[model samples]
Target: MASSTVNRWLRPEVYPLFAAVGVAVGICGFQLVRNICTNPEVRVTKENRAAGVLDNFDEGEKYSQHFVRRFVRNKSPEIMPSINSFFSDPKL
Candidate 1:
């Protein structure tokens, strides 16, 4: 019964929905982890607590320059830039 249900969902017509769901889940997971690891208000460690510092200035600065942070920071806000541009073009 379970195998039949799995086979039904594995059809090509359902692939795009699965891909979209997977991407959404991946993005949400990444953001959740990034915020937990980097956001000063939510991240608390023994070093930070013992030091009596609410915010780790140096660590924050260092993390801001990390490759992933830099890439995300500089990335365009648009999700589909090409399609957006094509539709918005005055000449179209």
Candidate 2:
């Protein structure tokens, strides 16, 4: 009886969860792209890549991104704060 109940509702009920998850993901992705586009300090251009930090990141701006690749790779939140602190340190 329990198995039959699960089989009946599982397909229909599970879809709302999928839709909720999709909407959540789409909103988050949009926000990220929006922020990146607005920030002039982290401008994305072929010339910037060729020149490295000399041309852009070290323009004495706060929140300058030098270690973006490393920052994104560390997914753990507990470890993420440490990554921020390490990167923010003037010693680096």
lDDT of each: 0.81, 0.68
Backbone clash total, candidate 1? 0
All candidates' TM-scores?
0.54, 0.37
Q: lDDT of model 1 at residue 17?
A: 100
Name the runs in model 1 displaced over 4 angstroms.
Answer: 46-92
The number of the candidate with the highest TM-score is 1
For residues 1-92, what per-residue lDDT tens digits would candidate 1 score against the true structure? 99999999989999999999999999999988988888665636766657654556877787668887677896889999999988998893
* Lowest lDDT block of 10, candidate 2: 57-66
Evaluated at residue 76, the lDDT of candidate 1 is 83
What is the lDDT for 43 in model 1?
A: 36
Best by lDDT: 1
Model 2: clashing residue pairs? none
